[model samples]
Target chain A: MNTDPTRLSAAELAHAIASKELSSVEVVQAHLDRIAAVDADVHAFLHVDGAGALDAARAVDERRASGEDLHVLAGVPIAVKDVMATKGLPTTCGSKILEGWIPPYDATLVSRLKAAGMPILGKTNMDEFAMGSSTEHSAYGPTHNPWDLTRIPGGSGGGSSAVVAAYEAPLAIGTDTGGSIRQPASVTGTVGVKPTYGGVSRYGLVALASSLDQAGPCTRTVLDAALLHSVIGGHDPMDSTSINAPVPSVVEAARRADVKGLKVGVIKELGGEGYQAGVRARFDESVTLLQEAGAEVVEVSCPSFDYALAAYYLILPSEASSNLAKFDAMRYGLRVLPEGIEDPSAEQVMAATRDAGFGDEVKRRIILGTYALSSGYYDAYYGQAQKVRRLIANDFSTAFEQVDVLVSPTAPTTAFKLGDKLDDPMSMYLQDVATIPANLAGVPGMSLPSGLADEDGLPTGIQILAPATQDERLYNVGAALEKMLVDRWGGPLLAKAPQLTAKGA
Target chain B: MPPEHARGRFVVREAPRLAPMSALSRDDVAHLAGLARIDLSDAELDRMVGELGVILESVAKVQEVAADEIEPMSHPLPLTNVTRPDEVRPSLGAEAALAAAPEKEQQRFSVPRILDED
Candidate 1:
């Protein structure tokens, strides 16, 4: 057996623990040690709950020793994005407003993870309120890309992807509103999936854009994501938007790993012009590989996709404005008194506290949202964006009629320098262009490492989009492509990544 | 009442026309920040004016095709009101509910004065 547990996938770790060849405590401790060794440089985690994780691992070991059946992913340690509410663990959403605040209850998904006996490593960092493209927006500071220390590991789920890429955790949970999961996964050379909207319960996920937010698995391999997804994806009456139907058989589809006779569409609008040369080359190579693997490939055009980024900005800020209004000084977060006021009013306190607590990006969006949803502008901005939303959904429906799944480069380019786009919001918004269309249309999308770019030698991801409720197709196609790509590279793409040396060594 | 298909749907009677968009001014941004209950500093306000102007100009493109007879999608899935039996169930107690409150008094969240003294 491999002595280093961090190098193993979550599936491998689970098998080792279940067979009694390794104890859950040992596996969890190994990851904790790995975190201690590399995380100072990586900065992937906002908090590391080492004691709680070890206790949970012990419980799993005891249950297994008593000959009790366990979930497939039981005993595996995982990191969670800070946006999910985990009781007793501080969840900051990478913003100072909620700093030091511990959630009173676990999110439904977190509760599910517990029920399945998975030990949570801790909360990972993200962009403030999941707002920016680079993790640089995190109030705690940015997570460096493990591939290249100076570059970003895409946002806002940068921490989740970085942990997996750096081998700090086998699996992690990430929320995607507009490419938060996939974009980071693309840049970090990992696998990320955004389950069909309503597929995963949103019950304790701090709302970003409610309509677009969906929590899913981030892992190093497609099958590992599948295993984690099945545990967390299901109907939750607590979330009204949760689908009443059973989860798609993603695990089964991933194991099948068959793409024969499947129809794959290369979205016409998602590539060209703004895309990097290496990204396009890698995407084209993946398409050819899919065709050779017995999947029929065709070019499908969705013209409304050109407006996806525009509509997303309007729709997100509008929804976010309403959702974030609850962060007034009175409850559950920071409070500040107006300067030079003897008896400040509630409104004044709220204004001052919000100004002090929120970072610039969060403030920017809230004000933008307030402006969009305001009278006179609502009809032109928010309403118009909602209409464009329908057009994008229609485009998906039209494209789905021609093919089983849509494919594209997950991001326009590989991860840029950490502070390169920090001051420019528009350029940062462009990172999510390809991934946003899936969220708008209520579809499931997966991003898997296609290959390292020829120019920068950084990872590039090929996105696979399946129509709503047909999320299994994404796994089937994704696993097949992942296998072919890995065989060509002679190993996982992460293996090609430069290794990180211990901080003090 | 309109038919099921027409309900909650917006119909544009006129041909789709682009809405005129003017760049957001500093005063406009300041007003927006006020509406949002965030007291932006003068420097922040100055920077936001230029940033918001660029973002607003880009997002305004949505108005181009929006004049068509398209129903606005507020949510991805068609969700009806989800309800359960009107029965008592275990929920968070007051102790736990107020656990995260910035300030609390007598098991209730404390807030700054909402009304002026008479």
Candidate 2:
């Protein structure tokens, strides 16, 4: 057995367990120890299900002993972003309102993970209700970047990103609504994919923006992400928006890792201007590498992309305002009675609870959404944003006509300092400018670590987008680029992350 | 460890302004807050008026591209009228459903009274 079982990727760990060379219990224990050693500083997990994970690992070992057929990813452990519900496990979604709320039912994806015999380590932290670019919006506190502890792990899935980067878990789940998944992956030097809208089930996911939210794998390798994607992606009768078609051949594509004859379109509008010098340099080098690898690279202009950020904020807030209306202090979650008032009305309690529970970013968006959806302003704001959404989708359809996949720098820059954009909401919103177009168009997008930016010595990620339902193309290009970058650096980008030792030990 | 302890560890960091503030009035913000059912103090409202004003001005660009011919799409997929047969299945039982309720009585969610006795 390897000295450190936690260091292996999910794919490798699965192979080891399948081969009988290593036990699932050992791997799970190693990860728990790693979490104990470092999570105090990283704070990736809101709750670590050490006992549950080990029990599941033992169950998998028994299944193997019985010679029963097991899933490919059986015995591998994963960290779930807290946004997804796990039956009997606390699913907080990084908000004080839902703190300590142990969901009675599992999200379809979580059930799938359990059925596949994947032990869930715990629920990871996230931006409060998945509302911010940096996890600082989390009511629990921010998840620091593993590369540089002073910096943020890109959010709202910062916890997932941090765990993968820090080697606490080999795989994780992250939902992207306006770049929650990809942006975090970019900044953390990991891999994250936002599967095609409706490509993955959203039944158990806590909704932020119904139209834009799609969960996918967060992993250290493109192949591992593809493997996890195969495990989780499928048609579900429970989710009306779920695609009835079969999950794309993402695993096969990742294994191929060949971009020969692929038309990779560099999005004309997604780069330059506000882009950091180091991010652009890394992105440019990756593009050149793709061209040299026999892929046909072209520049495709998606004009409506310019309005993507504007349309996304308006649409997201509008939907969020309506979706979040469920937390009314009635059925579930935190209920705060109005202070200094006897027999306060339910409405008064709800107002007070929300006022105390939700953080600034969540409040800001809710207000923006309420105003957008207001009766008088609906046509000019929410309605117009929906129209712009259509145009963005149209632009994607046209761009796909000339290209197999679109490429861009995942986020405008690498991970900024923890407090860099806290006061400025607009600057924080700009971080998702490159990744938002994919969610807007309902396309699949992947962010793979390109290289470390020269200026800040932080990781930069290259985003690959495929037309809706052709999600496999993202894996093909992503894997191809990941392999080339690994070869160039002589190791994975995450191998360069500064080790997190026990603080004050 | 109380949950609020986790919050208190990080100092509140404010963002630098990136967009020009527009004309969203304080009253407008208060009305939106009321509609959203989020009770905001006067200081928060004052800050929101400026923050939301800038956000609205930035997102107002959506109007520039809103053409009359372009139909608004509420979802990405074109399929509509998705329905399931109306058959009851086992679901969260009363105990499970009421378990997370902040206040419960008689297997029902208990809330503050709304009506005045006539």
Candidate 3:
């Protein structure tokens, strides 16, 4: 009890609350206080539900006092990405159009988290409509990286990863369309999982790319992510696309933390040349660590991965254009009238509202997507991208036959400076090169801190991908590598991050 | 546009650069905006044409390998048509459904006039 409970992992906090070493209220308050102290500098949360969180925490304490059996991670507090719908809390998806919209019903994952007795802390910031890599495109403002305020935390789930990295929250939910969760986790030195595409229910998740968006865990420790994953990853009748099978035993796999005799494949196409030198160095070191841990490491190539990023851009924007069509002014969210028009038509209003609401990136994507899905271009753009998608999935199917899991650098480099690649869309898209293939193929991927890069002293992440439904393998390998890295570094990677001081605190 | 300019700032070593596709034009962008129901200013259209041109040129690499024999994959799951029993269930009330509407009239979303008729 003497230690700051905010710094403890979710598992540790749950143990403390269950054993009466601390009340849920105390633990929740500690996190709330931490959020208040550091959030000014971090800007991770779009909204902090202090009162609602306290009430939920108190309910957990009451349940414990009444001797009612609770879920394993009960009383643990979590931050949710704004992309997921929250019943009472404002869910903006980082766009001005839905700035004040409060969803009337909870996302299935949010409902699951609440049922597990995890207090909903608040909605964290993200890129507009979960679109950008650096969270700079968020209509509200950019979320500053805690490691270096000038740098990005990575996005569109930057706030979720940043909250965990800044120790303001033990767990957060992030949706990964194209490495939104994993890349942010990579840059911020946290753990993120993009569950097998259909592994987690997508009900209530604001769609960016319907076929690609899968909400998953963002946490500081591999075990915590596993626990949160267990809570949120189950079949839901509400989501037709949800996997009907039982959630993979990722928690047990994380607990096992053994990869001895496992076949680990290094994707030949994912690395070399384009990767930053320091990132490559760290990845190579992690491979050696895995080899020493008794994993049989071999090189496996996915030749079709060459077209992955290209296919992804086409597929994502095409789906996003259709999915985002729901935001027409006739429905919920923003609506604006064209100026100087005494009688603004509905079409004009919709156009004016969209023009005012969407950022440059969102507009760019929508336009590109519309063009891709348009009559003449449909066969050439969207159709071709889908075919490439099949090839990418085929490559994964082939790779899994030779190896149990595949590993690569999570991203091409560590977090670049905010605004560095903002002007260049292609440069920004390249940041997600390694992580995109998994989403394209619907495979589960986890990114954990490898170590800090020598050049910038920024954290580099090693990504582990398991074939669809083999998600447990990722947890097993990730936990094993995490344990080894922690032992070598003498602590977790986030321990080395420069502490954030509240401005004028 | 040259191949390098079309690829923009980032270079993908593995992706074989294909012939640059038609450069996206302002009129094309405006037409796309109209289709998507997004109003864009002249500057936005100008900027977007250039940006989309680069993106389109780069993404055209997908056509290099996406042969006709390969089938398209729209969804990862094999789930075909997931239909539940048609029995009606409780859903959001009218007030709740329209809670976030920018303009509402008596629990229904009010919108700008569409038809010319009264």
Provide TM-scores for the models: 0.97, 0.96, 0.96
lDDT tens readout by residue for model 2, A245-304: 899999999999899898999998888899999999999999999999999999998878
Pairs that clash in candidate 2: A422-B14, A422-B15, A423-B14, A423-B15, A424-B15, A424-B16
What is the model-wide C-alpha lDDT for candidate 1?
0.92
Chain A TM-score vs. truth, each candidate: 0.99, 0.99, 0.99
Best by DockQ: 1
Error of 3 at A233 (Å): 0.6
Q: In candidate 1, what are the lDDT values of residues B9-108, reduced to their tens digit? A: 2332332333334557788888989999999999999998888878888887675563447788988999799999999999999999998898999989
Give me the runs in candidate 3 sitting further than 4 Å from their true place: A503-505, B1-22
Sort all candidates by DockQ, best to worst: 1, 3, 2
Say which prediction, candidate 2 or candidate 3, comes out ahead on TM-score: 3
Residue A417 displacement in candidate 2 (angstroms): 0.5
| Candidate 1 Cα outliers beyond 4 Å, as residue runs | B1-23
Q: Candidate 3 residues A183-271, lDDT tens each?
A: 99999999999999988889999999988999999999999999999999989999988998999999999999999999999999897
**Backbone clashes, each candidate:** 0, 6, 0
